[model samples]
Target: MIKRLINLPEKSSFFLFGARQTGKSTLVRENLKNGWYVDLLHSEEYHLYLKAPEQFRRNSVYKIEKEGVTEIVIDEIQRVPALLNEIHSLIADYPGTRFIMTGSSARKLCRGGVNLLGGRAVERRLHPLTYLEQKENFNLETALRFGTLVGCAGKSEIETQETLAAYADTYLREEIQSEGIARNLAGFSRFLDIAAARNGEIVNQTGIGRECGLSCNSVKSYYSILEDTLIGIRIDPYIKSVGKRVSAHPKYYLFDTGIANALQKQLTAGLDPVRRGRLFEQFIVLETYRMISYRRSEAELFYWRTRSGSEVDLLIVKHGTIQAAIEIKSGTSVAQPDCRGLRDFGQNNPDVPLFLVGAIGQPFFLGNVQVLPWERYLENLEQWL
Candidate 1:
């Protein structure tokens, strides 16, 4: 197994939040081997707590304390948010005990007003596998086609596709329906497909709602559900300066490329050149974002676009300053023409570093712009940032 970069604080409680199948349980099990585990996903456990959350602690916490176990792990804590009150009490009663809560969804907790363990627990996220963690085993093509879900990464093509397909149809759809996040299940179902097709694109609530037969506000809420479940990421437009006419809308990218394709009902591995290129860009953008997040860097990612079509695919901002800009091209070769966007952005922000990441190219410099193959860029990402 690849070692994750997330380091839990030894003295404090924490929340490990991620989408389903990101290996939260596996990581907890591996790291906290002796911790007392209470999986709310089990029907009996969930019902038991739903009946009397206080009694759960009286029975389970007492046994754990008696056995001298100080670490308590509660998987899918959102299923029984009422238990948070008891957890908070336990923490106060037993000063040495630390609770680790794992959740796949935060909507219920936040909306239900559950105790977040304020100032007591740190929050961390577990994302899909990154190139850094996978090292030599990372395959760009495979990642674009099958995503980097650890459980599905090394499997056969058919198996991987089938798994992702099931994830989209069963897990994603059912979870939303069970959560009762949407008033109309059919409309939400249709919105899922439309949204997936438009993944990695600028948000257009009115247009999306028109296609999905939903209202604009409903479409916005649906997107919120995606964010709450950790299945989608929104990158706001970079408009810190008024020198350029920048678009105000934000771009949304599905958490995983494979899941995005699965939701669109596309199982074919190969695509036409233009379609393939877009997917490649999405794949790289997600990888870059994940790398920065997994390392807990002080970098914020954004996209820059103007009315006349000048665009930089990604802008890495650190400490409220534009540190670096990148343009993604899915071609094997890079020429001067492909550096137009980066060149335009660099005209105003001369001090910021610019790069062009292509399918395959040796690291080279074109004036102020640095060009590198996507693989080489990822390998030397630290230097770029």
Candidate 2:
């Protein structure tokens, strides 16, 4: 089994949230082997808890008092948010017990106004497999093409495509439609296609709404649904004044490239140069996101762009200071012209380090900008900041 980068607290009760199939259950089961495991997805357990939330408390108490159980694992905690109150009380009653709650979506818990344990539980997220976790078996081309989801690992090309396609369908049926997150499934489906097509570009909600026959506010809500479900993340534009007109819109990236491709019905086709480039940039941004999340860094990610078309792909900001300005490229070779965005960004943020990351084999310097291979950059991402 591939080891995930997230380090769960040993003593503290915590909530693990991730999109489905990201391996939250597997990770928790592997680490907390002696815990009392409750699978909420099991219809019997779900209906029982849905009928009597106190039964969860009763059973938990019995296990703790008579069975000598010190750890309890509740899978898909969001399926029955009422259990949280019971869990909260249990935590207060039994200080020795550790509650490991896992959820595929936080929409119900957040919107339903359920008890969140009063800060008694720390929260951690699990993302799709990262290169660091895959190590020797990692393939850049495969990752960029099929994505790094755990389900895609070690599978045949056709099988991987099938997995991604099924994932998209499952997400729509279970997370969106069944959960009633989107009232109009057809409109939301249309919006998803447009969103996947415009993956890395600045979000134009109005334009997307027009195309999908949805209001701008509806589009925003749909985007929130995606975020709450851990299906994607939004990268806001860097807003620090740099004597240039900057775009205010944010860009949304699907959690996995394969999911994006599957949503767009491009999984079986060969990715053209333009599509490949976008996927490459998305891959690097995702890696940066995973690394920052796994390391629990205080840094936040943003993209720098001006109305004049000069743009830097990513910026690492920490404590109100720009740590690094990075431009992602899909090319194997870099030239002076490719550093234009970095140069433009450096003129205003001179103190911040500049980097141009791409498919190059070695690291080199193009003026003040450090050109690095994508892998090398991710391996030593902390040093750059």
Candidate 3:
């Protein structure tokens, strides 16, 4: 098992949120195995708590007081949002009990609850395995093709592809249905395809709605559902004005490339150079996101695109200032012409460091911009920030 960077607090309660199959359960089981465990995903347990969350409190508090169990681990806590009320009370009643709750989605938990855990639990997020955790065993091709979902990692290429395929089929499709996020499963399924095709591009709700036969509002709601479920991210445009025209629309990216490919109904064998390059860009953008989240840095991730067509693939903003601008290229070698966007952005905001990531094996300097390989760039991402 890979070691996750999200460390559970020794004394305080915390929430571990992540997309399904990102190793939340595995991490909790491995690290908090000694705790009093509850699996909300189990049908029996889910109904038991849904019927009476107080039973959980009665049982767990009894065990904590009598059995000397100081830690309580609840998996899939979102399954019964009502339990959060009881949990909040328990935290107050039993100060010694360290409550660790894991949930794949926050939509339910965020609804109509005063003092969600009564300000007692700190919220922490988990993402697909970061390059630092996968380190020496990391495979760029596999990650780009199949993504970093821990369950699919280290499997045979065929098995990895199959696992991702099944994940899309069973988890994404059925889970959304079960969650009642979208009433029309068929329409949501179609929207999934359109959204996947538009991944890594600026969102156009009207355009997507037209394609999916959904209203603009419906498309917008669907996107919100994705965000709420932690299956995709919507990055707002960097809006500092920076003496240049910038686009206003936000860009969207699904959490995993393999799942995106599956939603698009495309096999890895069908990936052309253009498609592969786009996927590579998505992979790097996602890796950067995961790294930043794991580090818990005070930075916001955004993409810069101007009305005149100049673009910086990513901008890292810290303390209301753009600290770094990054451009991603799928090619192995970098040429001066390819550095046009970074150069232009640098000309305007020379204080911000510029980086160009490509498939090149070794690092080189292109004018004022630093050109580095994808792996090296991800490995040293924190330093750049």
Candidate No. with top TM-score? 2
Model 2, span 144-233: residue lDDT tens = 788988767788999999988988877764458877788888888888888999998999889999999999999999988989998889
Residues forming the 10-long window of minimal summed lDDT in candidate 2: 240-249
User: Candidate 2 local accuracy as lDDT?
Assistant: 0.89
lDDT (10s digit) by residue, model 1, range 240-347: 764432435678889988898899887675866776788888888888887777677888889988788999999988888887899998988888989999999999
lDDT of 2 at 325: 93
Residue 336 of candidate 3: its Cα lDDT? 95
Name model 3 segments beyond 4 Å from true. 112-115, 241-247
Query: Candidate 2: deviation at residue 205, Å?
Result: 0.6
- State the weakest 10-residue window (summed lDDT) of model 1: 241-250
* Best-to-worst TM-score order: 2, 3, 1
lDDT (Cα, 0-100) at 1 in candidate 3: 66
What stretches of model 2 exceed 4 Å from their correct place?
241-247
TM-score of each: 0.95, 0.97, 0.95
TM-score of 1: 0.95
